[model samples]
Target chain A: MKIIVCIKQVPDPEHAKMDAKSGTVVREGVELMINPFDLYAVEEGLRLKEKMRGEVVAISMGPPQAEEALREVIGMGVDQCILLTSRDFAGADTWATSYTLAKACQKIGDYDVIICGKQAIDGDTAQVGPGIAAQLGIPQITFVRKIDEISEKNIKAERLVEGGYEVISSPLPILITVVKEINEPRLPTLKGRLNAKKAEIAHWGPEEIAADKDKIGINGSPTKVDEIFTPDLSKDGKIFNIEQLDAAAEEIVKKQKEMGLI
Target chain B: MGIKVIKEKCTGCGICFKVCQYGAITMAEKVHTLENGKEVKRLAVIDLGKCTLCSECVKPCPTSAIELKAEAHKFEGKENYKDVMVFAEQRRDEFEEAAFELVGKGRELADKLGVNLYALILGKDLKGKGEKLISYGADKVIAISDDSLFNFLPEPYTNILIRIIKKYKPSIFLAPSTTQGRALLSRAAGKIYTGLTADCTGLDVDSSGNLLQTRPAFGGSIKARILTPNMRPQMATVRPKVFKPLDRDPNRKGEIIEEKVPADLLKSTTKFEKWIEDTTSAISIEDADIIISGGRGLGCSDNFKILFELAEILGGAVGASRPTVDEGWIPYSHQVGQTGKTVGPKMYIAVGISGAIQHLEGMRSSDFIIAINKDPDAPIFKVADVGIVGDLFEVVPLLKEKLKRAING
Candidate 1:
């Protein structure tokens, strides 16, 4: 059975900042890293490779520099890397982005399975994976916390719910988006690191994928950001500080009365 | 540099070939001779250049043959301060507190931008609520009232919202971080192809009008402030209880424009299984005027006897951290953190708990925090308004007794 994993490079949210005046993020000088959740997806893929005795491939999309993220995956023992980068692919929303990715998947031809992180931290939409599955016309299971079983044509997984869990199964050519609780990603080894350094990363564009130019980037995207501003929270600005814990119980009741919220 | 293949490590599983979109890789048969002089045939490939380095195929290889390479590069773009808009949720004949809290927040941000505060409300029979929104300081209330919207589903809501957003194009859109809000907003953000910060604790406007959305990230260890440069309608979901609502003015008025929801867009894939009414009348931990929360050091369930008594005396609700819930001392619903609910009570009394980042992320917005733990070094004290280093068992019962005597006298 053949399997594939999709990954993304995102701004290191730790040092990320926004320009209050422009309503845009300051991407320059902000460190970039593989999304945290994608690490789980990579780990799950590697584990599947070990269990099934198959080869693993890493795929990503971004600017030319994002090749570094793919190399990191290569260092973790993935066999190959494919990068989708083009100037025409700018400003794509999840829908257009998913379309580009789905086109890429179709170009790749045959596959038995696909894995992705439940959501990207930078976006936090948790839609791309499912969108890819929808575009592929394949079955999908999301927020998968555990893999119950995997046969040649079927896979069973434990999906996290509000309480307890639900068991779900899907046929082959399926897509699965995973959560952080799924697994701890493995660190790259000395041998894997050396392999990654010597590896050759590949790049693709809309022309190569035969992707519709109209549906590839910002032009293909249906939604647009019209305006951006900070949220306001200037209520009456009331404050009641309780210096003593023993007196807090009474102070709180009185404060609630004054506010009339209860 | 992009992801590369260690052909030597390739298992000929065809996983990478299946993931490659540029068709840059094609499998060919090659014979390998083993030590025993046995010949093995495997799939071999291919040249580069055509590759896009998208990393779509890295995770599926079973033999660990895929990897990603990082390189330093710049994302070219210009900067923006978008407008501020909040989704004013009206359901079950009333407005959700989260919506009001977000409106209060949106109003302040709009003032900072010198822009109009747009409140988007959709529901059945919400015209009366629209006036209250104006009193709360919304510059305008865009109301879409229809029975079809009575049941909050994704398709129609997202479609109509997408239309409104396309027309007005506010800079920032705020939604409450409730299950329903999250369900619709998360998808809506993605459908529109923009950035969304989930469960934000704080929202601020810089001089330029850019939305500063701060939320806990990375299992709650770090606070991440997100900004969507070059993207309009930078979106965020603020947890309930994180902000206060404005005082009501009955005479307040604003422009209330009525919109329509199309019936064709009303269908959804997700079913409404059931609505389990909130069983506990105990004030929502987030709305509680006072909260008596327990930590791991509360010792055991029996030890909470004093906590309950104190909570009852204070006429407030009881809360617990993830640790207490894990220890089986309380139900999981009471757990608060990155996994549980975010709360901001007027006064929060934490007994015998060392606050982890995850736990702190959920309750740091409380008006006043009081921590009582034997360890003075506990992280909870970092944000506590009052810190007492001692045994909670000894201190809580005594504190409760003192409070009761003072009240009775």
Candidate 2:
């Protein structure tokens, strides 16, 4: 089984800022990390590789610095890493991004399974995973919390729904978007870090993947961001000290009563 | 400019009918003689008399059966679209409360736009549920009744919704930002080629008729208002509990249109095996009225038991910060933050939570907030209506005793 994991390098959202005048995200001077959720995907891929004796490849689409994320994943035990970076790929929405990733998958060719985080925190759009599955015409199960069983030909997993969990089974060459409950990601060891430093990172661009110029970036995206502005948070409230804890609790109960909530 | 169904590609999914606010599309059984003299199937038919040529139904046809006769002329301006439509999501044969909440907000937006408010409902044998929606302020209810729709599946649901949008051409579309809603609406929006604002904390229409979608940006440090000025059928997914539902009026009456779904379109690549409800968290954190959440400051997983006990006494639910959940102290379902679940309860009590912006993003909208932390400078105190600068272990036990006595009295 050949398992591929898709990861992304995101500006640490905690420190990420937005340019007020331009209404665009400002990444300068911000710390970058492997999208926290993607760590679980890479770990799951590595675990599956360890169990099934197959190679695990980590793929990421971003600026050149995204190679850092791939190299970090390599240290987590991935056999190979591929970085799909290009100027043409900038400003892509979920559809265009998924299209490019699907094209990269086609270039990679032989693969039994693809894994991705349920959503990227920065975009907060879970569309890319399903969009990739749609583009590849493969079965996809998103919000997967557990892998119940896995074989060379088929895989069964428990995916999260609105109110419950659904156990779904899909054939090989399928895509699964994992949630945080899946497994705890392991830290990189000294030997693993040494191997990561020596590993060769493959770089692929639009031409290498045979991607269409019109469909690889902003031009291919259907939706466009028309405007962005800061929201008003001007409401005022009272704050009390620890000595006033009982009084505050009493006031809250009183307010709840006024609002007809027991 | 009217919508046309390609006979060969028509799957009769009835998504067109479900979305049509004008009741223009209907599923009818048609017999066609094969070359060998065999008869066949039913298809969706469009009534030109009732159709307003909105060209909204073209996208949701599973097989791409529907098309606008003149694509360029179909959407000449925003004037062609009318009314606000809310996707009334259902689960286990019942409507989610968020459905009513969206309808409530839809009602306000529709009234502002001076158009009718329509609720698009899809489910299995949802008899009389349309009436319930009407009581909650839906001017008209378009329902697609099918057994396959009992559970939310992205492909079929998205296809149906896209067809509805193409046929009815609602000016605004609202869906609850739940997991199912996000999946369904995102795919449908992609097919419809429209901009969708996800997890909006606030929604309103500008004087120029553009939907103003406000959501937290850069991890709750700031809120951003996003707009899609050049798009039709403005789409937004609203978080649950942000708005209150209207008072129910059983005496209210509205029109209900029922549509059928084609069996072929229901065939999907994925299959559902079984539903396992998380019995431990019987009430989801999103729906909880009062929430008692703990954070890493609580020390360890065993410390969570006291918070759970406090929650039980308060008749509320237990919630945790992302760190505690990441530490494996609690399940992800109990997490309250940007990555976990956004909640707006009546009252939120934080025990030993340091109030990271990410954590505040989820619970900031709560009506009343009280924070308990030993550190006086914890960020949580900035947003908390009351701050207790004391040890949680000592403060929590005292507060719980006071609450138990108060409730008993």
Candidate 3:
């Protein structure tokens, strides 16, 4: 069971604030962390590796700093990691990003499974995982909440849908995008951290991966953003202070009642 | 490797630096050897590592110094592509509300482009069902009803959609942003080498007959207008409830043709064993008139019970913010935020929610919003109709008691 998990480093959503005046994000003190959902994917990969006794490899396509994210994952028991960083990979939409990642996977050659988070917090597209699977022409079980069964040949998983969950079974060399409900991520052990620090992270660029020049970056990306602007969040709503909690509560109730809203 | 600052065009105005939200842009002092003396010019340098390529900074530059170099893909047989087609996602022979919404929007776009609106009904037992779309707005509905097409396996669904797309080149394609819809359509678009924008809240056909897809990016903090200018079928998945479904007209007539997909192409490596329908979805937050949503301020999972109690009293459904849902306090089905469901209830009571812009995007459309948080400066208060600066554990109970007494009396 050769497990491959894809992760992303994103600005912490809690600290990713906006400058009201400029209508742009305020990034001075914002910190970067592994995309919250991807942690579950990594955890699932680690669990699968522990059960099946194969290597769990983590892959991330980001700037050089994104190597820090891969190192963190390695500290959490991933056998090795790969950092796909290059100027050619900039401005990638889901298609280009997936294409590049898929090409990287092909370069890795032999792999049993590819796991990814349902979606990244920043983009919120949830398109890349399926896009990669599509480019690879492989089976995909997206929004997977749990892995019911697995073996060298096939796997059964529970996928989240609109109303409920669906139990799906797929053959080997499959891709699974997992949601947060999948599992709780484990912390890095002292020994694991030491190993992570000593591990030499493999670096791959377009040339190294044999990526097609036409499908490597922004130029290859089919969709182009014509315009970008901040959403106007300037709604003027009334505010009321609380003196005694009970009195404030009663007033609000009467207010809703008087307004015929209760 | 495209985004760059043209040194010759740059005046060192430093406007792009201020507009860059990613902190990727900085003013670098470059010594320019003038005719008389050396002059230090502050040129804007963009760090590719931090730049998301959102292209926001490009608009504010007076000199048009920054350029994203990419050729608009050219199609050889572009003239052959015609009409607008919608996926018409259905389960158990019943079309989702999103399908109807897409049909209505598709009808509008089709009219604007002087083309037809075609709906694809791909599923099992969809015998008389495809015609329902005609009443809403579809000009033609292609129904691919077969056993292999029953379950929405990504591979099979993608193959079927690709076949239809290849056969009839629609100028535009739309789908619901449901889990199945996103998974299936992304695969289809990728396989076909076309663009597919996700969770678009706005859709319109531009003057050049190009579909202008508008969607939120950066966790709903920013809006992006995307274009698949050179592609045959410009694809996008629309956020549910963003558009209203057109009224059904029995008098309206349209064509409904059943198409067959070869069994080999419909073969799915992924098999669906069972579907445990969310029985609780009957009271889903999307349809609720009053939604009392909790957040991290609720403290822990035990705190959700209060929200449920309040919801039960009001006969409404309980909702949770992204954090609470991500915290596993409640199910993802109850999450009401950007990454979750977009909801517009009559009355939304935010208990302990500090309203991130992402959460606000989903519920800001509510007719009346009441936010209760200890922090008066909480962003939720900014958009809330009634802002209560208090603790939820203390405030929620008293408010519930008063409301319960008033309703009973």
Candidate 4:
């Protein structure tokens, strides 16, 4: 079985700064990491590859430096790494992003399973993984915390829901978005790190993937953010407190009654 | 514009039919011949002119077949509504502080926009609380008495709200971004097909009455400013603790418009399984004076034991990074980040967390944060009020013992 793991390099938001004047993210002097969630996808792919004895390819779409993210995955024992880097892919929302990623997946044809993080940390819409599944015309599950079984013909998984869990089975070549509950990713050993240093990353672009230009960037995205501004901190925040737990709780309940909050 | 249902995809689940308030959809049969020359049964539907396009049908579809295609930028009309009203939420026979806080914030925008401030209170025998809402500066109180509304359910509440909103035509509607508020408002707004900004951190009014709603976007990396340009009752949901509640005065008085929940609308299609009491009352990381959190860098579950020890020393609750929860070292309920709880304690100590964007989204609002890690360049330090660049294995135990000594002394 062939497995493809899709990852993206995003600004380490902790160090990331937004340009006040332009209202855009400033990437300068900021560190980049494989999207934290995507690391789990890569690790899951590597784990499946080891059990099933197949090639694992790490695919990412970003600027040229995104190769670093894919190579780091290679260091974790992935068989190969693929970079879908291009200037044309900037400012893409979830819809356009899934389109480009599906194109890349198609270009790296004949995959049994595709894995992605439930959502990128940057977007948090949690839409892209399912979007890709929709675009590819495949069954998809989101918030998958555990993979119960994987075989040549089918994959059984447990999905996390608000109150309980859903154990569902799907046909092979399905796309899955994994939450942090999937599996703990292993660190690169000394030998694995050495292998990653010599491994060559394959770069693919819009031309290589033959992606539809219209559906590949901001142009393909239907949702546009009209305006962005800071919320004013003007609420009346009076801290109502007194001594005694029962009294405090009672006072709070009284206030709630007064406000019709109960 | 009218919404068209894809008949082939409709599962005859009656979800859309039951959810529709305007009685727009009805079951009809369409004949079709298969490749084997067989006739099949399929559900048919109709689009109603009064359909609000509130995307409620899209979620309950078991097959995930319903598609909601929205036309962009429908907000294009003169301002007709007046005042900003918040459905001040109540929990367990008490008013939530977040409600008055919304009223206080709405009061400022209402004054600026030259409109009255209205608070909608729905509860059983909660007239006393209705009086306090006006004292918090609500110019008008729309109190509806109903025993069913004692605990929140979608049916009569949404129907009543829709009726009141249509009658008054308030310019803006605000709801607390709590679980109940989010559930009701989302369905109600989606039913109306109006734009709503969720988890808003800030709100304001322009000279022309457009509600300027600010919320964290791009996964809390940046703040996104949103506006409902064409929609009436421009809606937003603000998170609790993000805003301050107001001071009340007994002398303040406002007219109370007592309304009744329409009996017909009380027949709800959804059922409530159980009322999950606010677990925060028992214990909450946000209310803790001091908080200790563990991140992935802790290396193992054995390491997290130190975190529990530290939290015990501080008399605080132990929190975990998103990764630690995934590692099964902790439960997801204790996870702290954008997807988890937003906490602001006096002291927040992050142990071994690298501080990803999602992680920061939840806790960036904390007052004083201290980050400890082995890596000097860990991103946790960026937001940490005090950065201790060292091995958490060595640093956590040492700090826990020291804190224990100080507390004992």
Model 3 DockQ (Cα-based): 0.54
Q: With candidate 1 superimposed using the best TM-score fit, by how many Å does residue A112's alpha carbon deviate from the native?
A: 11
> lDDT of all predictions, in order shown?
0.68, 0.78, 0.83, 0.67
For candidate 2, what is the DockQ?
A: 0.17
TM-score of chain A of each: 0.87, 0.89, 0.89, 0.86
Which is the leading candidate under lDDT?
3
Cα-lDDT of candidate 3: 0.83
Model 3: residues >4 Å from true position, as ranges?
A18-25, A241-262, B8-13, B19-23, B34-40, B48-52, B279-281, B286-290, B296-306, B309-316, B322-329, B336-347, B356-368, B390-409
**Chain B TM-score of predicted candidate 3 relative to the true chain B:** 0.86
Task: Indicate the docking level reached by candidate 2.
Answer: incorrect
lDDT of 4 at B240: 65
Better of 2 and 4 by DockQ: 2
Given candidate 4, what's the lDDT at residue B20? 40
TM-score of chain B of each: 0.71, 0.78, 0.86, 0.71
Candidate 1 residue-wise lDDT at B396: 79
| Higher-ranked by TM-score: 2 or 4 | 2
Task: Put down candidate 3 lDDT per residue, B1-409, tens digits, no spaces.
Answer: 4688877777889878866655688888867654555464777788987776768888778989999777666667877898899989886566778889999999999989899899998887886676788999998999887776677778878888999999989989899888888998888888888888998989988888888899877656678899987777789998876787899987789999878778888788999899887775356775566889999999999888898888888877888998888677888878887566667666789999988877876777676788999998887887777788888887888778877887787
* Interface RMSD of the candidates, in order: 11.2, 11.9, 3.9, 14.4
Query: How would you encode candidate 4's per-residue C-alpha lDDT over A80-150 as one tens digit per residue?
Result: 88887665665455556777888888888888889988666654545566556655655565567788788
Candidate 2 C-alpha error for residue B317, in Å:
1.3
Residue pairs in clash, model 3: none
TM-score of 4: 0.54
